[model samples]
Target: MTLAIETFHYRLAHPGYCAIPGAHPGQMVGSGQLFKRHESLLASPDPRRLDLRASLLDPFNHYRVKVFQQHSKIDVLVIADLSASMSIPGGATKLQIAADFLLSCAQSAFESGDNFGFIGCGHGIEKKWLFPKGLRMGRVQELARDLSRVRSGQGGNGLFQVEPYLPLRRSLVFLLSDFHFDLNRLSRLAGLFGRHAVVPLVLWDPAEYADLPEWGIVKFQDSENRRTRTLLMRPGLKRKIIEAYEQRRDRLRHGLRSKGAEPVFIEGRYEASALTNYFLQRVV
Candidate 1:
């Protein structure tokens, strides 16, 4: 089936709380908003920003200085899992869904005056997919096209290699992955986002657990290992598969949360508006 890609608008949930210094002039509190009075300064005071009334009111005529808030810009980065699991044949492949989501984020960041970047990881990170700062809308579209053509392969947590490419300053990071890798390895990866605003998008397919036919033999393959196995599809077996997936979900959520990351689970397709709403709620 053709993928139904939806586009939606988004805004930063919190516009004033970025820890790293930003370059763009904005309403956020920073060192760039001049001509604004904050408090008194005992050491050096700027004559231009001196409060005449406050200085005159003081018995000793102590000077009061005006402080300006700086305008800051944030970097938006989209990190995708390009492992074999993401290439599953179905209504919408995980990578395809990720490309659409990345497009939405690019649009949102562009509108909000933030730089956009993208990185794809499979066996190791794909350097071709890395779009650094100052990416235009046309460039984003080009990257999306390239993303659709890349193939998945055996990769053991290639995401761990992405840390070096990240911006030196704090950034708004969106991670798209199935989280099918070893759970123990996830904590190390999650810790990398401790100082940044991170959103983990978990892409799950219904066929992974819910599409099994009753009372039939089926073949299963491990996407990462390329190992195949045959098993009988029974009600009890299906139930167990689903239960195992749920347990893994819980573990993933807990593991990520422990490292200051929250996982947003999405099945089948993604809605940009829903994602924006989720960010709005979380940021507030």
Candidate 2:
């Protein structure tokens, strides 16, 4: 049953985001180098630009993203998956990292003279979608404020209701999700890519990558569904589980490639620069 998404007016700006600990001067590379790594951005990565982008990270938090705007008339939409699963034990759950990334990107867009907005979705049809376009920094503040308070519940994959909202503009979209959801409805990704430059960020925790568990039998509850299930892990079972996971990953990759949508794997545990580098250096 599809329920109408109650669209409420939520503002942006997070007190915590501002107070988030700052980084030391020499701990990281120059920001211009980060952007320059992506050939599509600037001629070179200037240290000055790197300083601003690098500040998005909390000195204590390792998850950080840098957003740059090279095109106007083009949009930069940040969609974060806020499913219940993202609330698990971790410094910054995939959801939080995504949210922070969006905030950082909004700031970058504002600086680059492009319009930006954000959408947070979970297991339902309705979503807290914000489409703040044009050269408006207020939108960034609105996005930050609204996202800080979002909560997630388990339900259907976010792919269903997302189709109607595609190509909000002939702009670029960054959809970040744990991606442990359904894939049959992946056509929406294809459609979004067809119209706009879209990238599907498959966010996965290290634990999710390899179903690691202590020796004893432990009952595990579904992240999306609270139901608990027992699994006896034999060598054969473990192999099958790992193989199935790999196959699913490959399938999604193939599906997106078929649709012309670039799929990037994002490991939530460590800093993965492959995709970000691709975004920054590959496209011209």
Candidate 3:
């Protein structure tokens, strides 16, 4: 069955630094509709954009030409954490949400005339899940299918090795994960992606913390290490568990903000409109 992919809108926070022309505001001066400034013809050397009035008014009598800001394209990438913990199901599996999110990104990027890429990392960068920047919808769909099948029992240590695969030029990067690991690793990863605009998609499930029973015996397994433990769920324990999750949320928020990344927390299921709203508010 074909998955339904919802497309969302986004814009770069700053002018694109890339030279390849496409559809985002850029610092490059070229043949675009937005006029930047008038420059001497000797410098700009574009007779077609010559300003006769400005040339005539020049105190030094130098020919003038108009310079316009050009629109440039940027790479859009999704770097997802495929650790075992991401497979835990609540309303939907985290990996399923991730795949849907990836589809949205791919569709959106394609509509916006930008190249999109995917990188799914676990213990290390998985070659099967690495896709370089491209505009092929077929490849994107294939990658999404592959992502949905992943059930890694490894940690997200491979994130450290992703820098080499990323574009050298600044791009918009979506980092998707449950982030059950150490915050220090997040800080380090943020530093590694310092050149790019990083948006952290924090995936969580209600079953993981919010919807626990107040009186029952619950068995929990560590997704990464395959360790199992049984706990008697009582009112006090439930409160403590929820409080712990809350504390972790605070830390993740602060950590991401400190590293100049604004995180979007997704609980239960993924929605395309929520992300679209984030970009809208950010642009505003």
The TM-score leader among the candidates is 3
Q: What lDDT score is found at residue 62 in candidate 2?
A: 30
TM-score of each: 0.82, 0.63, 0.94
Off by over 4 Å in 2: 1-73, 123-127, 132-151, 166-168, 209-211, 233-236, 269-275
List candidate 3 stretches off by more than 4 Å: none
Decide which is better by TM-score, 1 or 2.
Answer: 1
Tens digits of per-residue lDDT, candidate 3, 1-284, equal: 13678888988878998888988999999979999999999999989999999999999999999999999988999999888899875677888889889889999999888989988888898777788687488887877877777765777788777888998888899999999988877756755557888888999999988899999999999887788999999999999999999999999999888877789999977889999999988841
What tens-digit string does per-residue lDDT give for candidate 2 at 98-162? 65556556655554444565666666445446353442555555565555555556554664556
State residue 190's C-alpha deviation in candidate 1, in Å: 4.9
Predicted model with the maximum lDDT? 3
> What TM-score number comes out for model 1?
0.82
Question: Model 1, residue 223: displacement in angstroms?
Answer: 0.8
Worst window of 10 by summed lDDT in candidate 3: 185-194
Instruction: Mark the regions of model 1 whose C-alpha exceeds 4 Å error after superposition.
Output: 1-68
Clashing pairs in 1: 22-72, 22-73, 30-69, 30-70, 31-70, 32-69, 32-70, 33-68, 33-69
RMSD of each: 4.0, 15.8, 1.9
